[model samples]
Target: MTIRLGLQIPNFSYGTGIAELFPTVIAQAREAEAAGFDSVFVMDHFYQLPMLGSPDQPMLEAYTALGALATATERVQLGTLVTGNTYRNPTLLAKSITTLDVISRGRAVLGIGTGWFELEHDQLGFEFGTFTDRFEKLDEALQIILPMLKGERPTFAGKHYRVREAMANPRFRDHIPLMIGGSGEKKTIPLAVRHFDHLNVIAGFDELAAKIDVVKARCDDLGRDPATLETSMLVTAMVDERATPDLIPSGMRQRMVVGSAESIAEQLQEKVFDAGVDGVIMNLPTSVQGYQPGQITALGAALKPLTAG
Candidate 1:
């Protein structure tokens, strides 16, 4: 369930047409599998992130993409980097993930979070609730989803979601790994300690040490071992000749890695792994060399040894 090393395909606009888009994605996932990555993730979004590109840019639905990737790669665990809880019903969400587990032969990891993008909700006709409201929904949704994943039909009533004897069938595994992506101490970390097996910390690199400490403290508060709750952070990797440190976006400077594969690995070792986080999920959205045939392999070769344990 640990994500020591993972690849996240967060971009779809490759300047190559739609026909070539998925093939590039498949190639990257296969490369990741061949080069020792333990997991592969795709961003769960309907529109391109503002930082990456315009909203109109191509963004494949996460589950559909992962289901296809499951057949393409034999070993890599497949899941979304983080799924928005606002988009679907809890009962259906459980079914979708378990089905993916069956497709991937028990390789599905459910990475979910309180859906935040207001635009997606507004335009897609989903409810755009307040911050507190979203968290409440997430809490209730988990109540139904957890039991269903474990093969126990759960009957529950809550403010946001309720299901009576909800069941998921044709499951390949009794327990699929649960993950939530966020770094908030009060709500997210507590939920991670209570239910999630992994917490993908969404924080700046300079803040990682503190975030890990909070995760540990929350686990201790719940009388759970911090080691049991694995943690990872997404790093936008730009492995190319043009990977200048100054070229990084102001908001993303702390979270992105620039330069050669060796340098990128060294920076991660110093900036992220040394902070006590458990894993690194590298996202090569638009790195110049990243779309090339062998770049993912190069990065994996240079970085895998550090996280092999």
Candidate 2:
């Protein structure tokens, strides 16, 4: 089993402008590739964290940033950590991803999810409905987007979305892996079992092993092969030795492969075999320490050697 290493491109209002973030992101992608990392994933947020001060602070859109990443890195795959389906029309979203896949020469993964951040929807004037409603919309989005990607002229009439003809431009284009994020037992996991090529969850080795069991059971009930769904985790980490252990949630810390290289490598191995995850999207809380891109690049380099071991 080959475990792939990936990093999350953090976006928050740390008071640094896009000038600070863009070049750093480019450099990090380049360095991750050089260091033998497999992928780089970014977030999709419209507003910065209010806890970070100010409501309308700096936040980069996911797809546009991914377009830039297409030119920045040669080997490392680039896409969202997970894009919210509520943010865009299904047809338009499919077109953007298809264009991105073309530009990246078949390296884009459509990491999508049912939108969770209520603040984003409220601030952006989009409907902040019940969780059920949002999941319904997400289901519809997946149905429309998948067929559109596969050269079908799709027409979906859901409670949330309506499409007469979903035709992707630069039509019948390349295939990009569809990765769904979240661990909602009812909707998200079932959707993953049905549609996603990969499923991402935020949990430790033991907890993840249990969740994978649940997913496998669901797959069995659906008469689908559990192996068809590749498993992954989105982990939060702090590399600084001085940092307190309680920075992130305890569950996340267990998933986080921090500390020295050897220790981190051991944790990663456990995450792979024990957790049953094939990949990890390391979420470096750089904003917490005002870390430069090179700092992240260094972290990527430090972990890169362990991928081969």
Candidate 3:
């Protein structure tokens, strides 16, 4: 089968009511399903980035929003792009995924990362530690969280977290796929090779290839089959009627897929063949005028023939 496709709904609406965003998210999920997209993901940020708007701008938490999404859509799989490991305790986070998995009928994949946003953690009163310290914590968190699904009461003590017989009750039906998100070669790729079911990198073909090579080598050294680990990318895309000179924004194309249907398809092919990516999660243009429903529909149409088995 061909690599699956996903979309990142960045939660970019102009409103305050929590219920208001549901319609947009539901619509996007439906669009993804209709377009034959395999999954739909949302950012786990507590606040909007400054470039997008205000730092204090409205945003939603990860689990609560995902719970609502679980009830809203039917076919499309859903989860966070990269949930911050420091946000919640590992057992609690695993339970949250368990609950969401049941609610969504086993359609949840856990995307996790070491996390980089200090401002959010500070503003929200979560401890912000050193880089190496965070990676250490992440490694420990994975060990604690992964076993909880197997009905194991985990006991782990590290420099950051010390857990004693943490119980995960009423486990979900399946082992929710764990996806590691980041491009760090030494630390992130090794962790992914050892623990995660998938790896998500935000880079072009060249960088993605290099990271994949690193992970593959690590997997080989660990006596693991590299094919067992899936690869995915997060891409910003602007889909208009046709390609134009100014269609793509500067300093963004390296991380984005822009232009006509043919151009976009070529990029997708490169990701699959060159970078060995198994899937892509496109971040569709949210703020651009006349791009929402129409462009989304067009993108779905363009990708239909390619995604069709």
Candidate 4:
């Protein structure tokens, strides 16, 4: 259930031919596992995000890819960084993740969030609702999902969904760790405090401390222990001596780390961990260009110790 150090594969545009794409992905996953990463993630999106590239860029379906990855590696927990609730029916999402858990032999993490990508909904024929509407949907979806994961058949009726004694069979474990990704104090943090096992804080490096404080306050108000709710941050990483600060897009510079492996580790310890986050999940978008054999291994070797309990 712990994600001490994780790698997120956000892009699949390797310059190689189509057959080499998945082999490259497997190599990266194996490298992460060997180098001490406890978990691996992929972005849950139907189309490529604008920040990363054009809409038509290659993007694999999250759970299907995770199922395939389960057979290719022996360790390293697998899941999406966060699943969008609007993309699928709650009962179906529950079934899919449980199936993944069975395939992976109990190494599944349910990372979920209220849907945010408008283009996906518009193009894919999903409802593109207002912020409050999405949150309501997410809150109701969890009501159905949590009970099913615990092997209970729940009958629920809400504004967005209704389920009559829905059950998720063939589950490898009774409890799959739940992770919520976002830093919205009013909605997301409060939801995490009440329901999730982990909170993946999405914020700039400068805003991390404040976000952690808000999480603590929310826990306090609920008469809950803040320490029980684990936390992590997502950062864009560049692990090369030749990488320079100017190469980063201006809008993303504050949320990105650029340097050699050792320097990146130092920055994480000082900036991310020092702000009270439990660990980090790094996304190396540059790897799609062509990753050197040992880049992930070197970064993992330097970073894992800092995240150890």
Q: Distance from true position, residue 154, model 4, in Å?
A: 0.5
TM-score for each candidate, following the candidate numbering = 0.97, 0.88, 0.91, 0.98
Candidate 2 per-residue lDDT, tens place, 73-144, comes to: 787777887888888988989999998888888788888987778988987887879888888888888889
Name the runs in model 4 displaced over 4 angstroms.
none
**Residue pairs in clash, model 1:** none
Q: Which candidate is the best by lDDT?
A: 4
> Model 4: number of clashes?
0
lDDT of 2 at 182: 79
Worst 10-residue lDDT window for candidate 3 reads 287-296
- Checking candidate 4 for backbone clashes, the offending pairs are none
lDDT of 4 at 60: 88
Q: So what's the TM-score on candidate 4?
A: 0.98
RMSD of each: 1.3, 2.8, 2.4, 1.1
Clashes of each: 0, 0, 0, 0
lDDT of 3 by residue, 196-236 (tens): 88888766656777777887899999999988888888777
lDDT scores of the candidates, listed in order? 0.90, 0.74, 0.76, 0.91
Model 2 clash pairs are none
| Model 3 CA lDDT for position 204 | 64
lDDT of 1 by residue, 180-231 (tens): 9998888988999999899999999989999999888888888999989999
- Span of ten consecutive residues with least summed lDDT in model 4: 284-293
Please, what are the lDDT tens digits per residue for candidate 4 over residues 115-202?
A: 8999999999999799999999999999999999999999999999999999999999999999999999999999999999999998
- Regions of model 1 farther than 4 Å from truth: 287-290
Query: In terms of TM-score, how similar is model 2 to the real structure?
Result: 0.88
